[model samples]
Target: MLSLRPGSSGSLAPESSGAVIHPSAKCLIKRSIDILGALVGLVLLGLVAGPIAIAIRLDSPGPIFYAQTRYGLKGKPFTIWKFRSMVQNADLLKQTVSNQAQGLIFKNENDPRITRVGRVLRKTSLDEFPQFWNVLRGDMSLVGTRPPTEDEVSHYSSHHWRRLDVKPGITGQWQISGRSAIRDFEEIVHLDLHYQDIWSPWYDLQVIVKTITILLDRRGAY
Candidate 1:
């Protein structure tokens, strides 16, 4: 469980750390790991991706991949990619449906937009594989906070904006902890800010390990 620290004005500090370090060095180290890890993961998964792409095409009528605009470091916008896991018109359909999760996040276990293949991809988290390319491109890190969608960003308070102080990530504390199970927007913001406050190369490693375990268990994955 994450322990929250109190920031000025009753805002949550989000993460625990014993000391502060130079932000530049931290950025360099984190980027180096992202590049190295992404390169290696791509190499190892290269063979696997081809068949997965074919399966997706066979299972769905749309493109094999999907991309959406998301907020990255310092609130910059970038396109984040994933395997197409819903009907081509899913976004257009969302407005007509009732959302299942609380606060600014939307999650419905019974969402009708999910394609047949999308269910498997989401369960295994294979949909997120393309983001390694984003990591390589420096639009993201291997670990930090999950990038918020533009709609989600629009709802952020000033305290929540603190999450943008670091690059968005492929996985982070919230992911490893409970992911979609976390319904409160403030809790998600707290997790992101926590990651920023205590970030380090070692912390990245820890989060990655936890991510692997969470993925294997397939817990809290929609």
Candidate 2:
């Protein structure tokens, strides 16, 4: 089990002073797969990025990409980029919207901030394409825990910090296991910890396959 405490910088680190303790944190095979998979994903993103950009531009008046700070491994902050899927002032208007999900995370199935094009992007999971760059840059893995916002982690309990033991992922157990339907943050944490408990290259491959299947069936992302 990994024990974590908040760092002075607001990040989480191992409670004991030593090399990183998470098994996946030091796995060369996983890193190699992250790199290879990210490369392929980036190529696919490039093929569709133009069309997506055009649609976003025509449907909304904002930058094609939206970048926001998200917590990565050990609660470290990094900029997460996605195709802009909301109005220009979506972040500013967040407080006005009610959070439908329970616990720390926030979600609204009918969020008014989402533009028409944004809905399609989100439905297809194309909005998440740019994170491939994060994977290539080592800020994220192809499969890991869902990256939390700084606000969400602000209220995290010590045990909740354990999920950050691995790098934040583009898709993970939470995503594959009915993400939109799972309203409780603790359940998501359980799945995150479960992934760490079962960290294996084969398991990551399985998750990748499942994610693809969900996307193909149009059953992922809302």
Candidate 3:
């Protein structure tokens, strides 16, 4: 089991208690799984990506991609790619619209910036399909902590920053647990740390299976 300590500011504390190294066998196995799973997903999705791209282009007047700066492993910065799901300049327009979710994160179920095709893509989580490429490129894993935006990264306390110690992931404990339903940033950090402490190839496989169910049910996604 993992330990959780309270930070000086009362938020969660970073796992500064020294590194808990995973077995080399576990690390190699997990990486192999990530590579193989991502490859298969990319091949399968490739067949459908063209039609989706066309749909997005027809429904919106913006570039086909949405790239945002996100924090990756060890708190490094990387750009995360997604099929553009919002209108051009959506980032600039975020402040002008009313935010629907609680805490530091922003989520608006009826965000005006979303295009018609974007709504479909978001509902099916097709927007995230592009991230498989990130996994292949080694910027992300098939499962781990969801990468935070650069702005969100800035607000993290040292404890919250523990999520950055590992690679940013396409999906993780948070996504399988509740995703947008889990509103507290502190709770999110706690879950991410839990993952870091107990990570295994089997755990990743379990999360992937659960994610498929969650996607099909579409619970707590938005």
Candidate with best lDDT: 2
Candidate 2 residue lDDT tens string, 1-222: 345566766665546524455888678999999999999999999999999999999998999999999988767878899999999999999999999999999999999999999999999999999999999999999999999987777677768878888998999999899978888999999999999998898999999999999999988478
Mark the 10 consecutive residues where model 1 has the least summed lDDT: 16-25
RMSD of each: 7.1, 2.9, 5.9
lDDT of 1 by residue, 1-222 (tens): 334554544333335422333372256777788999899867756866898889888987888889998876656678899989999889999997788777778888878899878998898888888898988998888887778886776656556666767777889878987997887877888887777778778888999999999899889987
Full candidate order by lDDT, most accurate first: 2, 1, 3
Please, what's the RMSD in Å of model 1? 7.1
Q: Cα deviation in Å at residue 36, candidate 3?
A: 0.5
Candidate lDDT scores, in order, read 0.78, 0.89, 0.77
Instruction: Judge candidate 3 against the unseen true structure and give its global Cα lDDT, from 0 to 1.
Output: 0.77
Cα RMSD, model 2: 2.9
What value of lDDT does candidate 2 attain over all alpha carbons?
Answer: 0.89
lDDT of 3 by residue, 178-208 (tens): 8877877777888988988888788889999
Worst 10 residues of 2 by lDDT: 12-21
**So what's the TM-score on candidate 1?**
0.86
- Output the worst ten-in-a-row residue range by lDDT, candidate 3: 17-26
